[model samples]
Target: MNRFPLGVWLFALALAAVTALPYVAGALNAPSATLYSGAALVPSGAAVDYNSHLAKMWQGRRGEWDYQLLFTHEAHPGLPLVQGFYTLLGALSPFDLALTYHLARFVLTIGMVLALWVFASHFFETPSARWICLLLSTISAGWSWLLLFVPGATAQVGPIEFWLIDAYNLIGALFMPHFAAAVILQIAAFLTFEAWVRSAGAAWRGLLLLTALLAAMGIVQPYIILLSLPLLLILLGYYVISAKLLTWRRALWLLLPLAAHTALIVYQYVAINNDAVWRSFSEQNITASPDLLYYILGYLPFIIPILIGARTFVVDEADDRWWLPLLWVLLVAMLLYAPFPTQRRYLLGVQTPLAVLAAYGWTRAFLPRISAGRRPLLTGVYVTLTALAPALLIFANINAFAHPQMPATTAVYYSADELIGYEWLRGQANPDDLVLTTFGWDGQGSGGRMVAALGQRVFMGHWIETTRFEEKIAQIASFYNPVVPDEWRLMFLQNNGARYVWYDDSARVLGGWNPADAPFLEQVFSSGSVTIYRVRLNG
Candidate 1:
């Protein structure tokens, strides 16, 4: 009759209740069948991404061309993995695809939280570890952000993005073929846990397992996986120099794993550089300044435990062997590579490990000091504060998520306006007729590029990328930016597949330019938020 097991089970059950609270609220409180603006859901731009993929999937599933998802559909290899997972779950039903993806996101979030908690509990003293686990499981920025908001305009500012991040990370963990490939990462995480919990002999096995896990994770998402190395090295270096249990023989075994990991990473880097498929992957400017506030918000709850507990932890002299501050600075520098607007999601991989460190710090510093006499008071205070933390996160996310709203001209897939526009277009166009889209009025209201609006099998529209995509955008921008003559607009239309033109009065122009020539373009449809024109072919 061990009450300890009962206590642990109750604690875990309580954690589950806390985790599902938002879902329960969202289900009951939000409008029927309406998702909250920022709930952790599927991938952001999900409707758009799903629509695009479905078209491609449909072609393939229908036995048209064997599922050719090249440049037109999902451009990256990672997306294919997501699509494949969803496709299997959906089993060819569009409704199922949407429903399943959403459900999968929730499941993924739960799994991530569980994994983090298990990692904490396995590595630390019970009560201290339980606090760390509770804090992380209940109130991380990712946790709040995922539950409180609904999916909307930008992929970066949506709830489903949390699941997407988890999906990407987990996929990298489960798949990948290399030694420290994605699949191996879970093993590595387990091994790392073992190192802290077990004896020296057990720790060596953990290192060997860790090396292999890192190889697998590397295969799944090499960029993030590779970035993880310096931290691992720092930890390994600490164990080597400081641990009382470390003998030359044991150290040799540990170093062997490290050497193998390093060699494999180097090989992967070279192989990726040589491959045409991944050649452009690293070439893109995926850099941005790290948002310290975002990191704080994202990781603060779990991290606070580490901060409070920092002074009591036994710090190995080896901890300072490698300048950890310098390594951290380097990793921070790596954030600068994130592109233009500076996305926070790209930094999730780095943040995950850091949160764990913060948790460890908390346990070592604060948990042991609070005597049993004061425990209830401390627990009550922590719970009260923790309760407010989720609310604050939801508020912050809602405030941050709404700022970069889409313009009226941009068709956001699954948006009300976009759905209306699609209904209008379907009514106006014949089965065989073409409807050419102008810039911004593309694919199913999902803010797709203009080329996406060409609903017909044979049509082209303005798309922004490089060469043609860039050149075409430049051409349209020239007319749209500067006040242009009617004929110039007409000529521009001819250059693209200008079967029809659509404009939204509410859309903000990139430059201060007016379209006085709107009347001359043969106005075919006009509404408050949208305007359509059919260019006279001969004229």
Candidate 2:
């Protein structure tokens, strides 16, 4: 019996345990009031992305292919393969939505870590260096010392966004499915490429695997493929120049799969751009772009090590494998500054290659000078220094969960009864039926965005989703405004194809009119602070 298999299993179990530790603490020590108020134990506002996926999963179970991602304008393509797997598991044994979500996240996180370890092995022969790379990849943090010394830095730039940094693997894995999948696929692709480079017998097998992974990446997260293209091209150039057999003809042959992958990506974007609704929606929802200095500050841990590693590579031609990771970092950095809505998101899986480079720097540059006995102590010091910022961030998130600082209106607004209301709405309404509600963030009532997602129904939920958001919001306000005549309100609802109007405490604050008072609206359901009224189109 091989103990190696047992050892690997135990190691995986340990990783899972460590990964779940903070979440376990969060659940156990969640603010009593918040727990009672139906808030998720992890955090609020983090659910926006996860909720969208949950919506798709819910739809997927019903054999529906299209997802009404409320944050976007129209029904976007769902990750059927990913969602379908979960749906099948859900069918076999039921679990709480949040529990299932976290479980999936846990699996993906473990996969990412394992993939990073495998990828690092190609560049590093020493077990110590490989393990160091793995740990640094998982826990490395940004430069927070600069903020402490610089005047007004914290106030001007806000706290370091740990979620944006490459080393914050837990955040990406736990909260985002696409991100986790992309990370796994990206590393898997890299591993296959490396194997292809080294193998003589099964090189075609490696190419095939790499192509499948790249295509899967397109489906899992198109943006990842976009970021990966330049890096792949750089790798092709490296092989053409360095390898004897990798002549232009063979390199072009290698490029075929990538070219096809790129075409698919272009086609997907063209389809998105051609759709009037999706185009407007994506344009409106474009995230605020960050500056180069902001990116430098965020990835300083990896950047510093990579710079050192670059010098080592240049000076020593024997370690030519270093060129791959160096190119990866440079290409990704270029894409980060590329003019795009969500360029920052490309940083998700970069820690893998950076970890490799950083490990190289540590072993080649830093460790050679130290005595064997003293290396462990110095390594501890290096790791602690690297991990400082992430530790602070993890502590901040935990503290926020235990002693929440967000306003009650924003944090604990969604009660269990309200979620029940949304579930009930899902059961009652047709999937295509549009529900009209307030479109702004009032922070006082149940959000229509939640209703759109959890209810699995179409809605004029928020400005991000609704076309002509200001006008729609104003119209909704007028429809609920007590001063507005009942006839005008009725007309507005009919014009917008609104079959139902959901009113909550926030709605009352924004619009003085009550649904029960309108002759053209019939109260269908009422529970706690929520009320649902069916529009009396006939009347």
Candidate 3:
């Protein structure tokens, strides 16, 4: 039932290839030297978030099932699912960690592409409709390309991010594998539940399938539960109020899966909120929905069409299939503006359903009214408007990250000396030893977060993962200030559990408190301008 024609398979592969272009270019252009720092280069785009995953995988490679916030020094119990699928990938895969990352991304990208096609196949009967839906769902971006002409637009994400890019499938698939995995599972759960709903009222096997899919999604990508559970509730509501088809047995089919999945969701919620470190991470995990204009422009190609066909299943066809995706689109649309920290996350896989409705609308409602000569012009315009925006976004990303002839040292890129500094500390420092390095946004000081990925702790690293990120930044700044007394600096290091201070050029840029000035700091390793000094605990 999930299989599609050969053309569809090839189309999926092609889309996956599009997602891979930036990474391939980044790798070919990556800089090399006699010695390198860390196990991986900062990924071309989204380096900070990418490094956070590296920290998780590094911990997982060490055989820890629970993941700690390696970017921060705060002691807290590790969360099970927080290690995420990447951690599992690192633990099981024998290849180099960097290679493991790209390999998994490629495979997951393929999976996401195919999964989306299967979902489209279930909705659209005609090949033409299915293909149109595929194009819009996969590559379509907001009309943000127009914004590329605005002054200073080049400085930011420019056209691609006029709305949040993460809302779209192309960006979601290319993001961390977990995001891809989430999309794949979401589509899978969506398909499975629909199948169960259409089956015999008392089909126990269908309930089991629905239960397992929900439980799995809940465990791996729990934030999605925020979207999925409410969807299931509304679907059941439709069966009861709109159709009057749900008998007690049919109710059991939906209720059982809901109950089982709700338990997992509640457990996950309690677990995350209970831990102090993770609580901080959760509080900082804010993605409030953008203004109405961003989304309107972002999804402009499909919005009117989806509205044009919102009643497609009700008027043109009689079946349970359309309600599932239609309601999914509605639920996500309404909730995107709901009061919540993770409001924008409801967008995962939403465009697929919207695309499906848009295609249906075009074929059923809009195309029939248009003249034959005008239809071709409108179709071309629609296709171009949808595809060009995201294409430009991809090109912008590649231009910024992959075109550089030589890799420059930045917050993301490690210098030879910085790499040497990290390698020395890796061998010398014990597990959980907190290393002090000031965090900076980009360029020289930015690479400090990687110190955590190499298996040491950082006093502060990730802006989000580190507890009280601003407070820690202030503390580090004051510690390095020239006015701070040596006596206070010595006590500060010991108080915060800093066993070693990685005083590099970046750190020097912060203040004039040289390692030499602090007699309590015993210089143990030095490479170029980077030096590692052990805090004298007893002196």
Candidate 4:
């Protein structure tokens, strides 16, 4: 019999299709005013980051690396691997950035499915168990539907709120490059390391492959390496203890990847300056460190199964195979609350191991106890019960496509004409030119993120970009505040290095000061309510 049954592949495909339906529908009927609004098909928190990445890739295609001048100080410094990956895609479709975005999404979706399957296969021996694990991995819930009405139930216990099955990984894989690529590479690394562990000391090939995988992960997402290294070490320690012999050569092989990872981390933090790397750490600082209760509730499904099968996993030498997943869950739980700004990121790539453990629990402890004749019926009922949360999650996500939430201003929130104006600016402006526009809210014409992303130029202000954020906001207020003297505004523009000013209905609403009032400013492009003004420094 094939180790991975055909049923597992079929189920994986089905799950992928189910999850992708909403995005496909949104793409076919994209929202008005935005190109590739298909990204909004799922309500992802990282939409802005992903959109910014696409813009950077587009800018890189045009021979410019520093894409988001407003967010980071230098060009193409952070997420080089992610930027390069999409840059290649953008080059393939030189004429259309939107097409490139969708193509990247497609690649991410396929890649995630394959990675999940490969990772799960390493832990599961039975096809049925693997299928169960795959399906469960795709769904999440904060509350159990069965206990919805009970007082202080899962829903009522706000303190215990957590993703029963996190759909973010699935949603992000389709839209977010940093998330999708890092997750894919993380799984590959885990698989490679597991192969080496199983090979004992003899498989030099596995060690080399593991080293390469860790290095690649470091380039894409160094934090993943940071979170993964301790767990790998624990696994290595387990092997050393179980063998009862001092295998110095094997110990060196295991330490090689960790050493490489440590070097990458040092270089990324110490060697690279002017990178505006802090944006990644600071922007999402508020939600970076979730509490321990949140994680306990989030992985309850797997936790219950692990607890039930703890003895089987501990005492039996045959149960050594189960140690990796258990260790992974424990390590992830500890790291989620670790004293780090990106603690929440450790949650990524965790579900696969959790799913495997849950499946093991179901087959070994739960299913066998039932009578043989009733097993199929009971299994179907159990599967349906397990799927309820994810099924609802999928439905809710699909519903969000029609009534999408307003994301951060940096996302694909601009109207088509506004985008056209930004495209025009990209062609006409120099690489170093800075544009002044409104700072907050995506309300009609107010947000100036378009210039920063599409035009590859600096803007006056952004919420996430901390460099001179307060100073720039004050300058922008003074320039746009109608009560301010025109002379003061002109001096402000000159002092701040702003060469272009974009005026749309948003700029008008925020600050009624019009560029036309200033003789030094010349109108360069106008379409409908939107107009671009060039600051003639000499005039």
What TM-score does each of the candidates earn?
0.54, 0.86, 0.90, 0.82
Worst 10 residues of 2 by lDDT: 32-41
Name model 1 segments beyond 4 Å from true. 1-95, 141-222, 231-287, 290-308, 315-346, 349-364, 383-389, 393-417, 420-446, 449-539
Give the per-residue lDDT of model 3 (tens digit) for 282-347.
898888876666677777888878777657645775766677777788788888888889888788
**Compared with the true structure, what per-residue lDDT tens digits does model 4 show for residues 1-539?**
26445665565456556766655655544456665443442333334444455556666667654324344223334434433555555656655565566556656665676677677677776666766676656543333344455576555333222132222355445445456676688788877776776665568787778788887787666667666888787777776788433265667767777888777766655533434445442443343544455556555766776677766655655655666777877787787777776676677677767777777777777777778789778766755665555566557555655453344322434567677887788689875676776654222123334633563455533455425455555666677788998888777678767788888776776677778988889999998878999988975
lDDT of each: 0.42, 0.63, 0.73, 0.61
Clash count for candidate 1 is: 45
C-alpha lDDT (0 to 100) for residue 518 of candidate 3: 84
- The candidate that wins on TM-score is 3
Model 4 steric clash pairs: 66-75, 139-165, 140-165, 141-164, 141-165, 446-506
Q: Lowest summed lDDT over 10 consecutive residues: which window, candidate 3?
A: 35-44
Q: Which of the predicted structures, 1 or 4, would earn the higher lDDT when compared with the native?
A: 4
- Lowest lDDT 10-residue stretch of candidate 4: 158-167
lDDT of 2 by residue, 153-267 (tens): 6665543454353335645664554566678898888767766766664367777888888877876667776567877777767776866536676566567569767876776
In model 2, what lDDT does residue 532 have?
87
Steric clash pairs (candidate 2): none
lDDT of 1 by residue, 1-539 (tens): 25244554555455434444433443444432223322322223332443443334333333343222222211223223222332343354444333333444444444444444554454455665555544543343333343345454234433322423321233111111111122224424534633633364646566656676555454344444434666655555655676543555555665555566666667656754564434443343233433344444444554566567555444633343223323543564465354433343234344344445555554455645778688567756664564464454334333433432433212222334444565566677542343443333232222232222323221323121111333444554565665666677667666643555555532335444544355546776655556666767876
| TM-score-sorted candidate list, best first | 3, 2, 4, 1
In the order shown, the candidates' Cα RMSDs to the true structure are: 9.5, 3.8, 3.2, 4.5
